[model samples]
Target chain A: MCEILRLAFAAVFVLVVIITIPTKSMGADKEYGQYLSAECNACHAPSKKSGAGIPSLNGKPVPYLVSALLQYKNKSRKNAVMQMIAGRLDSEQINALAAYFSSLGK
Target chain B: MKKISRRQFTNAAALGLGALAIPNIAVGAKPKVVVVGGGAGGATAARYVAKDSKGAVDVTLIEASKRYYTCFYSNLYLGGLRNYGSIGHNYYGLAVNNGVNVVHDWAASVDAQNKRVKLASGSSVSYDRLILSPGIDFKYDSVPGYSAEVQSKMPHAWKSGTQTQLLKRQVLNMRKGGNFVIVPPTNPYRCPPGPYERVSMVAHLLKANNPKAKIIILDPKPKFSKQGLFMDGWERHYPGMIDWVDPGAHGGIKNVDGNKMEIKTDLDTFKADAASVIPAQKAGAIALAAGVNDGDWCPVNPNSMASKADSNIYVLGDASVAKSMPKSGFSANSQAKVAANAVRGELTGSKVFPARYSNTCWSLIATDDGIKVGASYKAGEKKIDVVSKFISKKGESAETRKTTYEESIDWYNGMTADMFS
Candidate 1:
């Protein structure tokens, strides 16, 4: 009887840990991604074949993108829109975004 | 699956981590969080969740593109003070500094009922909770002749990135003494002062590059942000280079013939060498798909930044109904922090507090000369309220001008660091 009780408790413990662990891990990435992408699409199109005055992001070189962002952040670029954005980022984030775009099929 | 109460976990963590009073709290296993956007609101929110949750949240930011171009400084590019590259940003730090899994994939759809999001790669990600901050979308249907096709020719460079740069290029390439007509949108659009400020910046450029060029603004609203200040600057800086027509003054857009570059109004029909028709806008498509946005913008609880439609979701940035705060990048970053804190609290069962938000927008009238407006906010019952506001004094002293300029740079760095770093 003692052995059975111990086994039961152990099984419950394992099951609870297994289920709650994933929930705790998922965090807000999905929500944040959904929100942010929608916001960005307001302006940027993944392609160069955008309608009207919108520029195409489909095939721009990664290095060029990175350089442009750094200039904006350093205040060498001086546009209000660019300043606000470049001013917001650190070096690490700039690289990540650059990597993502470079990987896209331009 | 060892279930422990909040106090028990705290005690355990405290004892285990030693003198740090590391609460003995056994944090539930970390959940995988995937954020789609890396702009103002998304970046800030991702940082908040990952930081507050410690290792309990595995955040993966999935932005289709790597770099972000803010709409805030595009006007500088228009004014020839900045370049297109200056406004871009990256998201690598979110992964390295915050342990966020930053993915570069297109999120095709969100399956809310299943708690899963679909990506372009045909993969699906399941989450305990989701946040959607997709921002704004142009409603092409509102205007008859302003579909995507017409926009290609008459470029409504209202949105950021390429459209903006293209518009700048077109303006730069226009013949000297040519007409550049800017059709400002009606009320409840993305940046109220944006069109006027843009005209100011463009007029400044035209004055220097193409002195004989003209800019006519057709505004739907009678009143706008710092109207007096803008008019004063236009008169003093770029006299006769810019003209403004408010709908009340018969300046509203009636119809457009894209081929002819003609715009008809109540009183007159005007044709231009170039025209920019900034259309009406609403929340992004995904927000609509998720049923987060009722109409154009998603409505959220001001204090928590949580959605009214679903408790499991939060909305921020231009996509949200954060009226007390204007729909600008600064406002988005501020609101993102609030939303991030609230999400962290929800996940950890920690105490969630009311939030305070602030926004400042600086517009350049000339290369060195600029104007600004700022407001502080507190959460009200249903909305955020502007508690305090300020603007750069009209006649800026040398000291004030220098300080404002320096502060703008600091603000850019500080705010971006707060969001992405």
Candidate 2:
């Protein structure tokens, strides 16, 4: 009985850690992405249609957004402004942006 | 799959229990935030604080004008590329959708210690935080013979309203082969590329309407923004129609007779058919009134955009002494986000993110010809520092230029919505 109780507590502990870790870092908070998206909204407004060749970011798949941002960061993408903006973003920020924008599509 | 989902829900439930220890907002009284000016910086900040705070903060925007005209694209309107209404933005979206209180009144004075602002209508509003983005005010005395009293005649047209319309009318009315003189202000003016773009647009109008007419720019500074590009575009499109005379060549503008429409340069007195005299500038009068100004502009804490003079006040846009950042709408909008985050975090205990900023200034030399310069910024220890930058190359293809021009049209739509909607 003692061993079984210990195992149950350990499972709860592991699960809590798994779920709460992202919140502690502030990147995974949907609220943070919503706040950060204010910057992107300056150019990619949801209400306004994209101009020139500027593409929309709302409702895009997470993998596609992440990959595109990564390509821009790595200079594989051709746009000068995108490369400059993407170069400043880290992995977590990119993930957060992708997740936030994807969720907005729904 | 059901068992796994049940376990995940249980984990989240336990975490929610732990989060109960954190204090939520006090429900009875909401904090009040007052923003002055409804331009790029003020509108964006007011909208963000209201939207993100979600009724936790009351936001009031006090602007003198009911409609804000963006100076960024006013040059296009001069060349008949865009209509006057196309560049004007209203505050209805901010009021109805975001729940921001939009009051069209001038902020006459700021009482910093009392944390309230007195409007021109004899009404006053109190606030927990104040944001001032009153933009630039010109120093007409900076020029030898220029003053505010004579603006109607020379028509600075720098503020982009009736003055812009007046200048356009003057351009349209000039006689054939007449000269249009432009006297640009010294360094640290609004939109470093603005006077140059004005030259291009004026030249475009002249080339179509009055081919024999000439446009001359008497620049105080030896070199101006996008000099080579503007010169190249001029040669190709409006060859010999424009002459950008540097200080060395023109010597100096000794005096200007607005009544006679003559500019007495050291070289000679050249009478103009019409002229635009953009004088030196200072921070908007309100910043100085609030005692936040260092000399001509207010110093800000780079990370939060909080006024160094007063902690409860934040300054943005042309009124701020943001190091290395030009006084453009894009820069103002970028700074507004940073200030909004800081304001929200302070008043509501929300998580504050690192301050990031970016600005892109696009100029149209002629129709289907556009160029841009931009930089990304990060909040550094002392100031906002540029992380990376890019400018349109000299020899870009015509296709590229056309695409860039189209992109600017898109950016205007997005930016205005970002500020108001």
Candidate 3:
């Protein structure tokens, strides 16, 4: 009986792990996106004019944002500063940032 | 990681409030955050805390000035590259748009015990968390024969505003072919590259207006930031127009007299038509009054920029000892975001993400000639460590340099917007 109860407790713990992991990541995505966008916001102003040296990211398609950052990271994009900034971002950061930026001005 | 339940937050906060013993007022009333100084750090922190909290936090910013002139780009004004009014900014966006209570008054002192800030207006504003980002204060006596009294005659122009205008007028209207001497400050000051950049801009102005005028640098240090890059640009653009005498070369600065406009050094006593005598520096007075300083600067936690002396207070910008990061406007703005996030989380129980910081300083040598150095930082247990870095090469193409110069203008617009908007 003791052995059986221990096995049941192990099963319940595994279930909790499965339930919690995605939720935690999902909840943190928006907040993390907001926090990390500050890095971009330092140079890419939300109030950027049309002729601004740096291009605006507001209202850009999420896929385009992700693609542009990835290109910069992959050395396909031209600007050295942008490349340096984009190089550090991981896939998770790129996706989340794209989502957050795309959500802006909506 | 386990999700933070309400009871879990309570227990964790109880253990965390070692110094303040602040109760769990997160439930009853919105948390209050008071930020002092309105330059790069303070304004950014105030706006972030207020905007991010979404009306959950009461944020008040205390600044003495009606208009803020950025020290970052003041050199451009001296160079005739930008208008004086172009560099100045106001707080309308932070107050009207972001819901920040902007109080135009001097922050006389900080009451850490009560978490209150005493203003020069005889009013005390209290806070759950107080951010002090009062930049730097000049140690006037650090330079022999230089004091606040003589500052009018030989203006430092280190802190932007009327002093900048005074220095500009002095430079522009000086006698033809006159000597323009600049005494760069010692180490660990704001913008490690500032004095050299100023020299470059001043040289740019003199090259156009008074081509025969001589510019001398009596540097306290044996070396300076971007020495190679600056020297190269100076030679290419203003050849034979600028000379830099290091401490070893000049022996040392013996005395300076504003009335006679002379700098007496061990090597020689040189008469100057105009001069900028930048003095030694310390954390601003309010930080000292707040008892947050260890010696000359407040030591802050690497992860949060919270004062090591007081958990409830965070020190930002040049006033704090941010190891490995130069004291710069960009550095201050970076630190402010981290502090804002941490403060908001402490009050609202919001998820506190890890802190990341980056800074880039751009300097223009002559028309279309620019150079940059930058690094990104991450918080470690003991200190903030550089993760990645880059600098402009010595022999970059003209196209690259022009692009860099233009990029700097855009960055200025973006940085100001980030702070104010």
Candidate 4:
């Protein structure tokens, strides 16, 4: 009976681990994205009204942001500053930033 | 490949559960943060602490003036590009939206040992951490024969507001073909490109209205920031209208007779219809009272912006001795975020990230001609060191310059909103 009880406990613990790992990783990525967003906020605003001549990045679609960043990194975008900034970001960081900005409300 | 067995999975899960159950000891009471000087640094720090902490930290901001006129764009105001109302900002949004306690009063002194501040209103406010961003104060008598009494005649206009308007009025009132003299401050001053931008704007005004009016820059420094770009634009747009005299050529300034509107240099005396005399600067007085200063400026840890003298005290913006960062509003705003994060982490047990900073200074030369210089920085062993830098090219097309000018306007709007709203 003790052997059976130990097996059940192990199965439940394994199930919890399987559930928690991916969620925790996702949460950490979002947090890191928030940190990186601090720099972007210096130019691309998060608030409504979009500032004068600057676009609002809040609530942008993840796919759209990803594509735009990739284009900037590939030198398709004309802005030298944007190209430089985008070139520094890797794919994982790009996805994280997109997710973070997309999660915000306009 | 070896696979994780059920026993290993269970052990890891149990450890994770134990870690989750451990309570955070720093979560006992709300921590209080007091910030002095509600300019770019103080305002951004106050807003971020109040907003991000989500009621975990109480923030109080003390500013002497109710309305803050930004020193960044005051030159544009003088050039008639922006209005007085546009450059001015108030603390109302910070109080109502961000939940910051905005106290419109003078912060007289800092009691560092006790971590309390004494206000001019005779009240004392205590804090768990203090942030001082008191900006810069002019070194009195740095310029010979120049004092507060002579400001009305040769306005510095460095601090913005009424002084800006006064300088603009004096420029407008000058006779046609008259000379306007600008004595830019020595090195390690606020806004390295500022005097040159003012010269550009003044020339812009003269080129249109007072076509024959000439601008004479008596620069103490041999070479100024963005010298190449500024000289290129000046020659292109306002030829024969601007003459820059370096200290070598002018033999340095000797004295100024404000009564006669004349400047006496070792080489020759120059009489002007309008003049701007910017003096050398030091850290604001409160930093010294707080005992956070090395000499003229406060020394802070580059990573966290915490005072090297006292860990609980943080200094940001122009008053802090940031080694590689130019003293500008954008640099102050960037430093504030790094400091804010460190403060929040200490008080609220939030995760602290490595510090990263960036600054871009944009200057409008003509109506549509703009140039910029900027860099990204990371905290190094001893100071914030530059990582990457860029400057506008000398021979950019008109369309590119206009776009750059537009971008600066956007940045102004975005940065202000980020600080206030």
RMSD of each: 12.8, 5.8, 4.9, 5.0
Q: Residue B369 error for model 3, in Å?
A: 1.3
Per-candidate DockQ vs. reference: 0.03, 0.56, 0.53, 0.52
How does each model score on TM-score? 0.74, 0.91, 0.91, 0.91
Between candidates 3 and 4, the one scoring higher on DockQ is 3
* C-alpha positional error of residue B87 in candidate 4 after TM-score superposition, expressed in Å: 0.6
Task: Enumerate residue pairs that collide in model 2.
Answer: none
Mark the 10 consecutive residues where model 1 chain A has the least summed lDDT.
A27-36
Highest lDDT model number:
3
What does the lDDT read for residue B95 in candidate 4? 97
Q: Is candidate 1 or 4 superior in lDDT? A: 4
Better by DockQ, candidate 2 or 1: 2
Give interface RMSD, every candidate, in order. 12.3, 1.3, 1.2, 2.0
Report the C-alpha lDDT of model 2 over B359-384, residue by residue, as the tens digit. Answer: 99989999999999999888888888
> Candidate 2: deviation at residue B130, Å?
0.4
Model 3 C-alpha lDDT per residue in residues B199-250, reported as the tens digit of each score? 9999999988999999999989999998999999999999999999999989
**Which tens-of-lDDT digit does each residue in B1-421 have in candidate 4?**
1113522543454455334323433455567899999999999999988988888788999999999999988999988899999999999999999999999998999888888999999998999889999999988588999998899999999898899999999999999999999999998899999999999999888887899999999988899999999999999999999999999999999998889999999889999999999999988889988989998999899988999999989999999999899999999999999988888777765656678888889999999898888888889999999887788998899999998988888888888887888
Task: Output the better candidate (3/4) by lDDT.
Answer: 3
Cα deviation of A103, candidate 1, in Å: 39
Question: For residues A11-55, what per-residue lDDT tens digits would candidate 1 score against the true structure?
Answer: 999999997676445322233322233223323444533233334
Native contacts retained per candidate? 0.00, 0.63, 0.57, 0.48
- Model 1 C-alpha lDDT per residue in residues B1-421, reported as the tens digit of each score: 2323633664454344332211323443455555656778788778778876777766767677788787777787778877788777788778788888777877678787887878888987776567776777788766657888888767777767878877887788888799999887766777777888789888888888899999988877787897887887788888888888878777457787789888888879887877788888888777787788877789999887888998777788888899888988888877877776666555555434347677778776765566778776779987898766667667766555555555554455555656666
Model 2 lDDT tens row, A26-95: 4555765686687788777675454555666889888998899999999998877788889988776787
Scored against the true structure, residue B264 in model 2 reaches a CA lDDT of 90
